[model samples]
Target: MQWTKLLCNYRELQLVGTLNGGQSFRWTYNKDTDEWIGVFSKTAWKLRQKDDYLEYQVLGSLLPEFSGNNTQIKNGNAKTCEESIFKSLLEKYFRLDVNLGSYYKEWSAKDELFKSACQQFYGIRMLNQEPVENLFSFICSQNNHISRISSMVEKLCTHYGEEICHHEGITYYAFPEVEKLSEAKVADCICLMSLNHLKALPVDTHVYQIAAQNYLPHLRGKKNVTEKMYAEIGDHFRLLYGDLAGWAHTVLFCADLKKFQSTDHKKEADEGVKAKKKRRQ
Candidate 1:
C-alpha cells in the first residue's frame, strides 16, 4: 500500500538534518530517484518530501511469519487502520508535534551558545528514533564519524540481522537485537540507552567544547576534558534546558562539529538581536 501526508510547518524537519543528525544510519538519499530510502520492518520504504507533503511507498513488507496473517483484512479495517497507523508512525518518528519555532525562541533566549546553534540550525528537529537501535548505534559511535558509524551499523545488520526485504536489488535487514549483539560480544553497548531515558545529553567533544566555552567556564583553560565530565556537562545543560535537552543537544552538537556552520549561526543571531533592538527602539 501507499500513503501521503502534508507535513505543514515542517521547516524544522529538514531531511538533511534528520538523516545526518548522527542517529539511526539506515536512511539514504538517491538523487537519481529523488527519494529517501529507509528500512523499517525490513521493508525499504521510499519517501519523497514535496513542498508540503511526504509521499511514501511501502515496496513490500518482509518477515514472512507476519505477512500471512490476514486477520487485519478479515477485520475489514485494514486499509483505513493501516493507513492511519503509517501516518501516526511517521508523525511520532519525526516528532511532528514539536513546535520548533517555540523551542528556538526559548532556547535562544536561554544562552548564547544555544542561541547560536538554534539560529544556525533553526529547522533541525531531533528524530525520535527506535530506542534499542539508537542505544547500540551510539555504542558503535564512539570516536567514529557518521559515515563510519553508518558502515558499522550496516555490517552489523547484514551479518546478524534477520532479512527483511529486497527492492531494486537492495536488501534491507533489521537491526540485530540486544541478545544477538550480546552473543557476539558487542553487548557492551546494549546495556546503556542513557542518551534519552535518563535525560542525559549526547555530549560528544563538540558539545563538550561548546559547553565549556559558553556554560561550563571552569573547563575553558583545561587541555583535556575527561569522560566523567561528559555526564556532568550533560547534567548542567539539562538543568538549564529540561527534558528535551537531548534534542537540543543534537542540534547544538551538529553546530559544534561544523556540520552546521558558525557563520550561519552568527548571522541568525545578529539578525535576531537587530530585530529585538528594533522592537525596543
Candidate 2:
C-alpha cells in the first residue's frame, strides 16, 4: 500500500486552532508503510494505494479506489488531477463562487481587523471544505479541546467500524456513518462525547453564537434550545452549500480576526451611544 500525503500542504489545515485545530490531525506519508497515516490523539487512520490510486476513510478505516466497499476515484500518477479534485470539490461543496468578491469587500469594509488578519494569516484567500464531516467534526468539537476531540473521533471510528484493508501493513476507518451516530447511545458516546461542554474554539459554538446573536435573536432568551437548534444551523449551511458545510465551519472557525472586528463594533456602538447622551445633555 502506498500512502499519499494528505492535508499538510493545505494552508487551511495548517493554521492551528483553526477548524478546531486540524493540526491535531498529524498527517504523514509513511514510505516504510507505503501508506498515509493520519494519527489523531486516540485513534489512527491509514490511506493505502490500490491498483492505481490511494484512498482512506475515518469511521470505517482505510480503503482504496479499487476496494469494492468504497466508490471513489483513485488518483496516483495524476498528482495535479488529485489536488485539483480536492480543491474543486472543496469549492463546490461550499458554494464559494457565490458573490464571494462582494462578500470579501463587505467584510473588508466592516471588519478591517479581519481583512488585515486574513492577509497576514492566510495571504488574503478563502479556503473552503466539505459539509458532512465538517458538521460532525464541529459537533465533536463542542466543549472539547483539540487533542481530546481528535482522540474521541478516532475512538468512535475504531469502536464501531470496518477496516479498509489495502496493502499488507496499512489500514484505516472511514468517518462514522450517520446511521452509527443516529443509533449511538449517550452512554456509548459519553466515553467520547463532549456535547455542550462549550469550548472557546468549537466551530459549532462559534457559529451557534454568531447566528444566535445575529440571526435568531429570540433564541437568546429562550430556555429550551434543543439539539434541534444546533442541527438546524448545521442544516442551514448544508442546504445552502451542498458540499461546503465543512468549509463554512472552517471559515467561521478560523475567522479569529473577526473576533477583533466584533470587539471593535461593540466599542463603536458604545461610543456612539455615549456621544448621543452627551449631545442630549
What tens digits encode model 1's per-residue C-alpha lDDT throughout 140-241?
788888889989989998998877666778887887777887522223123212223425465556676888887788887666667778768878878877
Q: Which candidate is the best by TM-score?
A: 1
Error of 2 at 85 (Å): 6.3
lDDT of 2 by residue, 64-143 (tens): 42344332322223345544544344333223345444444444455444355444233122223223333455557567
Q: How far in Å is the alpha carbon of 16 misplaced in model 2?
A: 5.9
Q: What global local distance difference test value does model 2 have?
A: 0.42
TM-score for predicted model 1 compared with the true structure = 0.76
Q: What's the lDDT for residue 84 in model 2?
A: 57
Score candidate 2 by TM-score against the native: 0.42
